[model samples]
Target: MTFNLLLSLSIALTLVAAAPGPGVIMTVTRTLQFGLTAGLLVVAGIVAMDLVVLMATLAGLNLLTLANQPGLLTLLMVIASLVLIVLGIQSWRRPIILRLDEGHASVSHFMAGIAVSLTNPVLFYLAFLPVFIDLDALTLHDQIVLLALISGVLTLVLGAYALLAAKLKTWLFEQHPERQLWLNRISATVLFILAITLIHSTIS
Candidate 1:
């Protein structure tokens, strides 16, 4: 990837990371139910699993390229765009529900974290990352660099959330319950706009 493209993808990934989604909610819930240590472990697990997903996505994309499946790329772009749009709209309309108390009653925080991160739609969205990067053209070294950058950024963002949840548990869960919803809507709007831009580019 070009330096500029890598930078852009990094920014996009960071923005996605900042969004208040299932993974973030789970991270905060684990902090409240367990402790800061557990929460950080959860965050660690999340990052590790996401990296695995990213690798799988890259391998699958490479195989598609080897098979000369250009249509699959276009189809993925459309599907991903629609998914983002739908998710954004749903988030915008959904009511906020603070359910920290509803977290897993008996499970290892780290294990739960890995499970959530792996199943998280946002992480799976990495499958469509080729919409931004030329996956087929990327050398193994280039892929490693991009993956490392993504993992680093994801760790930073999720770690910040874990720290905040650990430090301000009561304030976040009690005093500012609605903040999560507000952040979710904002993130959703951004995703919607991004999807629209992608669609427009595809059509053009």
Candidate 2:
């Protein structure tokens, strides 16, 4: 990718990833509950979902196609909204904790992250893959380069969040065990709002 293209992509991706959304909330929750290691695993899951969405979009299974389909987009929005609501309610009802005896930290955290990340369609439409589509003028090699840079920057930015979460985990656990629940509610709220907005946009 050209430097300018790479620079633009980096800036855009940073802003998108840095935004307070479901992924960010998940990372923070994981960090507070488990630690940096678990949070990083969540980040990996989010990135993996991004790659999947990108590939799907590139292969013609895009949001636009769903939007064009009569009820598909609306259904997706409804399902996503419901998932967020359930997650929010669940978070509100439970204390977020790290069960050290449950299983291997890495596997458990990664699996949870992957599951949570896959539930949000907005991540694909709002975040990473859009950058690739938007920069379609670039050659394949340049596109790959740009994607790599974007992913690398995202990893760093997200990893930093995980580290911060790990550092603050003790404080969060001690002072406010309910902090994770609050974060979950906030994340769910955002997701719910996005779902409604998406449905409205699709129908209009």
Best by TM-score: 2
Candidate 1 colliding pairs:
none
The regions of model 2 sitting more than 4 angstroms off are 59-62, 70-90, 93-136, 175-204
Q: What's the CA error at residue 144 for candidate 1, in Å?
A: 0.8
If scored against the real structure, what TM-score would every candidate get? 0.59, 0.65
lDDT: worst 10-residue window of model 2: 95-104
lDDT of each: 0.66, 0.63
Q: What are the per-residue Cα lDDT tens digits for candidate 1 across 1-204? A: 788988998899889888987568757655654457767777877787777667767776453342244465456556656755665675577565566443333335566566455334433544558678776777999989978988898888888888887677566656677776765677467556657765664454
Clashing pairs in 2: none
Output the TM-score of candidate 2: 0.65
TM-score of 1: 0.59
RMSD values for the candidates in order, in angstroms, are 9.0, 4.8
lDDT of 1 at 46: 79
